[model samples]
Target: MKFSPHAWAKLIYLRDRGTTEVGGFGITDPGQPRFVKDIVLVSQSCTEITVAFDDTAVADFFDDQIDAGRHPEQFARIWIHTHPGRSAEPSGVDHETFARVFGNCDWAVMFILARNGATYAELKRTGNPHSEPLSVGIDFRDEFAGSNQAVWEGEYLRCVQAAPMPPIWDLDLLPGDEPYLSEQWPWLPI
Candidate 1:
């Protein structure tokens, strides 16, 4: 769950402005120092305790990467969201959502960001569905220069102002219309 300085900076900016955003990106490799790149940010509402992403956001992220010549399946996925005014620790719902949606990946990471910059991150391997989440530390390096700082700040503000969108999946989908557990997320086999 280690984040690049640029990613951390952008996340910190969002936290300071009281924005709740859902973020995810593809990882470059399978092990160590797990550098996440090309993070795509999704806007959220002020009242949200758990930020969620729409299918369009997920599709667009992969679409852009594919257009740039990268295969969507080539990257491991990590999903993140802000938990404002709460402990950065993952909630029960967080654990369930992470396990259910990302269960098919070889491994996946769920990160929670809080207002004070306190964070709780967990890395899970799908093999042990009920295993306790391994808490991980974030490596937020100080790499923001003046220009990039300003840009990150502006994006944060824009995030706060962005129109709120509803969650992509309806909690009460009609029985047969409901996606199977494996189908809840796109990158997995049913």
Candidate 2:
């Protein structure tokens, strides 16, 4: 599934913000770094994808959006967020999170960014034990201004010009529970 222009903009915006913080989303605890989970992108074309954050702020953002009535169906949830020292591939924590949440949705999107600015995005289908890397290709019509650069799927370059961003979903809160997916990433078995 390809991301829309608007969604790409949001991902870039969040990436910029994440660049400043050690792990992203402002969690400074050494043992409790930030992560994202349960994200959704409702696009007019293709499948409306949901991104699940292994990180807390990402999840909270979705909750806020839902409270604001942005996403009504909450059809699919994509799991996304950054990996500070690792690649964008799903970790053990990611596997466990997917196992627990995969039953609720049809797709998953994962965004991994290194500390030095290298980034990668992945889209996964439910019940699929693996996450596929999304090849990102950038197109620049004007060489002088880097702002005009457009990102596209490397495999399908002509599709569009865009980037990736964090998405929020409208999910209902279960009773008597704090959000299981929190900003502080509690390491769980895959």
Candidate 3:
């Protein structure tokens, strides 16, 4: 799939903005649904390993896009997200979320961009057990808008809340230590 220069730059900026993962929706060209012309980010809580969009924010985004006269194909089919690590491979969590959330759509794309510039994109269609892998690239031929850091930064700050995931292990405790495990996980009776 192709991204407009403007969208590509914005994605790169968003990916490098912080340590946590970030996600957004790609706005496609009306006549060319596979060509992402822009991007719109929704409010979300993000950690190093995950990004969860706010349901209300997502609904509002749909409303706003509808009000703007854009169809769902133009705004909702492409799920764009970043990987804070080097690998662009989707995790188990990503697979679960993609199937649970976007599986109902006629067609959808899950796109991941890693910090090392590695990318992974897969297109899923209803009734198809196998997904198609797509090549990602920047399309510079289009007359794209320039990046507005002020606007992008504002959107990033307003939409993304960096909620760090707690470490699974306490450095002071060994694997056999029960006390630390019990303290760390109060819900579990260790």
Candidate 4:
């Protein structure tokens, strides 16, 4: 998939700015949903290996985007995230979350950017549970906006809540207790 230069730079900056994973939705051109023009982050809690987006924050993002006259296809179809490690390969959690969360949509894209500059992208569509691999690249041909570090930093600070992975003992759950993980990562199956 093609990303505008500004969006590509922003994703790289966000990826390098932290040791934990960070995720956001891609804003694409209305006419060309595969061509991402920007990235919009929602409030989320992050550990080294996981990123849990806040449901309320996602709702607010939808409302704000609609108010601005953008369609859902423009703002919600592409999921962009960073992998803090060298491999951009999707982990089991990533696969499960992608399937459960974006499965119902007519089409969607999941893109991963890694710290070591590796990347992975795939497109999923209704009726096709199997994802089609996509090439990732920056589209410099577009008249892209320059990076705005201050704004990006502000957004990162406002939306990303980095947290340590809770130890197993710290969970303190009895056998019959509801799975706490399902709550923190609502998109994952219990």
Q: What TM-score against the true fold does each predicted structure earn?
A: 0.64, 0.38, 0.87, 0.87
Which segments of candidate 2 are over 4 A away from where they belong? 1-63, 67-69, 72-76, 127-131, 137-190
| Cα misplacement distance, residue 178 of candidate 2 (Å) | 33
Better lDDT candidate (1, 3): 3
RMSD of 1: 9.4
Model 1 lDDT-worst window of ten: 173-182
Evaluation by TM-score, superior candidate among 1 and 3: 3
**By lDDT, is 3 or 4 better?**
3
2 or 3, greater by lDDT: 3
The global C-alpha lDDT for each of the candidates, from Candidate 1 onward, is 0.54, 0.36, 0.85, 0.83
Off by over 4 Å in 4: 166-190
- Candidate 4 lDDT, tens digit per residue, 18-131? 888899999987799899889989999987567889999999999999999999999998998887766677766777788788888999998988788888899998888677
lDDT order, best first, reads 3, 4, 1, 2
- Expressed as tens digits, the lDDT of each residue in 1-190 for candidate 3 is 9999989899998999999889999999689988998889999999866789999999999999999999999999999999877777776677878889899999999999989899999999999999999999999986768789888899999999998674654222222234423544444344
Q: Specify the poorest-scoring 10-residue window by lDDT in model 4.
A: 171-180
The sequence of per-residue lDDT tens digits that candidate 2 reaches over residues 4-115 is 3433444454434322211222111122111221223221111111133334544665576667664422322443344433234444444555557554556554455443
Q: What is the lDDT of candidate 1?
A: 0.54
Pairs clashing within candidate 3: none
